[model samples]
Target chain A: MSAPRPVYDPSWDRANPNEVRRSIRERGYTGYTAGLAPGFVQANICILPKDWAEDFLLFCQRNPKPCPLLTRSDVGDPSLPALSDNIDIRTDVPRYQIFRNGEFTEEVTDIRSHWRDDLVTFAFGCSFSFEEALQDDGIPLRFLANNNVAGVYVSTMPTEAAGPFEAPLIVTMRSFTPQNAIRAIQITSRFPNVHGAPVHIGDPAQIGVDLAKRYQNVGDPTVGEGEIPVFWACGLTPQFAVMKAKPPFCITHAPSSMLVTDLRNSSLAVM
Target chain B: MSAPRPVYDPSWDRANPNEVRRSIRERGYTGYTAGLAPGFVQANICILPKDWAEDFLLFCQRNPKPCPLLTRSDVGDPSLPALSDNIDIRTDVPRYQIFRNGEFTEEVTDIRSHWRDDLVTFAFGCSFSFEEALQDDGIPLRFLANNNVAGVYVSTMPTEAAGPFEAPLIVTMRSFTPQNAIRAIQITSRFPNVHGAPVHIGDPAQIGVDLAKRYQNVGDPTVGEGEIPVFWACGLTPQFAVMKAKPPFCITHAPSSMLVTDLRNSSLAVM
Candidate 1:
């Protein structure tokens, strides 16, 4: 059996984000990036042909909470100058998932060979920014201790469609005591660029979310007794929409692997 | 026998705050100030003898959410220049409740006859400002239609004490659909001076509150089916603490009657 994945290392908390990106580009750090570069913003990356990029941009504008657009690269340009100067999207991301007609085709560390002249890159904000804010405020996140990500689910709520992009809004669920949940709502509300506040709290059934059946069973979904489940609009929402839209060719960062950026998490706070 | 309390009038939405206060000062309006001067901030008033005022101020400082101090009157001075150029605490409030040795003794239309040189007036932020925000955002408040105020409850949470000023935290509970509740939390968070966001949500028993048993059975305490109850730190908390401290003399605005101010509710938004 493959060696068990490594637990978060405390030293990663102090690592420079650019150094971490270099490691990711060099294939020296292929693991998921949870604890590394604690203060910087990490993004959900999606690359699609220019023809499909227009509709995706409208989709993000229509549903900001689910797809908070951080920056969009120019057509056929690999660098997102707004996020970083030295970055090259194709080689900087730790892993890339290739999709063919809405079906996952393969996973690779670098997409240099698959890069296209007609491609456009979109970087959407991720939850790690607000999660760091929550932790900084002393709100405990139990899932982090177990090396598990938040529970992901497809909610009954429908997204405002844009062209061919239409799908159920996907959400990430985290549980907290009623007190901390209120605090989490306040803390997250400050970062409107990063999912900004929860979409639902309390009864999961109200949103048609079954706590026992997380989407793809990607993480620990168990909510302890006395803890209330809070749900935030997830970054996976755009990918789910991509699956439904069935663009001829598409690429996304692998789950749990994200595009590290030079933007400070605090800089994202609108307040 | 009370000539059926008047329902909210639409014209009050356009009434000038200072003009409305003038009517209150002249006894033309002796009714509750709920809908009058719609966009203005109305304050909860508390007057205490100089000896007890110091400790009461300390109590408010220690428990800001429940008793957000808007302005404090100079000892023996009736004017609050910070709130308005012409505000006279003794005459501006529509009604006042007099307490002797912590027991409410009488309610009167005016407190000018009882003014003293050693008396100090304290004005606090009220939930009405935030309520107006919630309504403006299209969050329907069912209790307002029935002319019922939020349920008042004595929670298990205790307040930090100063001198003899100590009591259980008094909370005002309102019920909303989960969706509106999230919006309410966000809207209220913008007005920190007005009790801020909710202290607790969901299961009431977790905070030792029984839905059927409200403090003194004031207002309607019902939680409708499928609606979630959100509890906010109430301005009544300081009054409760005053009752517990048993100071020789105290004065507060009668329930539902408040001091009108020239400050617009929008000015209170921190963000």
Candidate 2:
């Protein structure tokens, strides 16, 4: 890997999605984009070649909770006009992960050098939007306070297969008191595009998870006293499917590095 | 005390609330009224002397989940115009339970002979409204199929009290698979007037329920192997408070002998 590059610029602290994209496209901002352009929607980026886009789209359609498609770019197109006016699929995202034959190839700040005419970009809604909604409603999320994402677990449950894209269901768990858990469910149910509510709650073992171990060690899974763990369909689920499918080529946003969009989080609420 | 008086007339089968009330008013129907007047709202009745009405009203307001007031009659007025047209509260309900000094005295088909000029009547939203919604959404309610109501339990949690009313919160339990339990919460959340959503789910012991021993033996509480017990605040909660208050005189609907009203159950959905 090349030397680590700064991912954030303080000048873009309160920048809007367009402003953030300008900095990312100019190669000034290349780090994780978790808090940048707050109140706007940030999406998980997945760019599959046109040959594989059909199967991936079908896969996403079948498993909407994990892969809720926000917008899909036409073949050979680099811009997602629906999400942002100038969202260049190759440069708007801070960091991108490249894979070849289901194997990790390398990470790059800009995919301009690797851009292909056959590339088709698909943006899926991420949990950040709903998490912001929860916090706005006075629901405290422990992981956010601890500067971590939700802990992920690969459940034994299988996802419906489309072509070779099949893998165990991936889940992310957050702990909350029973009362807050109910409130969280109600709040998240409003934003169906962003995973929408929880897939499982209460017993972790019931979903084939051991509380002590998480797939990526992304967040704290302590599940403190009087708190129950609620699991949501994770955005990483599609990435897992790509790895299992062993497509000739695949591209995705690196962990915590997302494509900030012009869409307001509030607009995503179905209610 | 008195040998059972027939509560339903065959002619009243599939009748509207007004039709059913007409037969009930003539003292020809005096049995349980469940499964009658299918689409209309049926309420749990509570009648108190004017002096005790204020405190009971406050209690119901403070504990809305349990004592959701559908409508309360004006003092000494036999008509509940808000619930139905040309209806008389004193004679509308199928059977009335008479209490003296907070102790059950007897059951009567009508309360005209015992009515005092200062009497006040309160009608609370019952689970039947939301249960109908649940069944309409294709959620199978096992207890309903068995001709029973939900199992009842008195939780150790104390309810907010008013002047002379203070008692433990009473809950009703229903069993559903995890998937259906989540759907149940969503469906019921729409009808706030009729106990919305569930207060607790999963382990019954977490809420002080043994499952093996229901409070009144009202229904089958046996949770199937994969089903979990979900508990909702019961309308009977206020009756428990009345039992503690020991008012000079009180009248309530006999079990399953509700006051059928002209209000359509669909009208209660806040959404």
Q: After superposition, how far is residue B81 of candidate 2 from its true place, in Å?
A: 1.8
Pairs clashing within candidate 1: none
**CA shift of A250, model 2, Å:** 1.4
Give chain B TM-scores in order.
Answer: 0.94, 0.95
The CA lDDT at B18 in model 2 is 78
Local accuracy of candidate 1 as per-residue lDDT tens digits, A1-271: 1222435544443268888888777634666776777799999999999999999999999999999999999998999999999899999887789999999998888999999999999999999999899999999888888877899999998899999998898999999999899999999989999999899998999899998888988766878888889999998898899998999899998877788899999999987
Tens-digit lDDT string for candidate 1 (B1-271): 1222435545443268787778778745667887777899999999999999898999999999999999999999999987899898888887788999999898887888999999999999899999899999999878889988889999998889998899889998999988888889999999989999999999999889998888988766877777889999999999999988888999999888889899999999887
lDDT of each: 0.88, 0.86
List, residue by residue over A1-271, the lDDT tens digit for candidate 2.
4434454456664458888888888846777777778999999988999999999999999899999899999999999999977878887887899999999999988999999999999999999999999999998888898778888899876678898788788998888876677778888889999999788877777779897888967677778776777889988899999988888888999878789999999999988
CAPRI rating of model 2: acceptable
Per-residue lDDT of candidate 2, residues B161-213 (tens digit):
99999878899989887667777888888888999878887767777888888
Considering chain A alone, report the TM-score of candidate 2 relative to the true chain A: 0.95
Taking all chains together, each candidate's TM-score versus the true structure is 0.94, 0.94
DockQ of 2: 0.45
DockQ score of each predicted structure, in the order shown: 0.78, 0.45
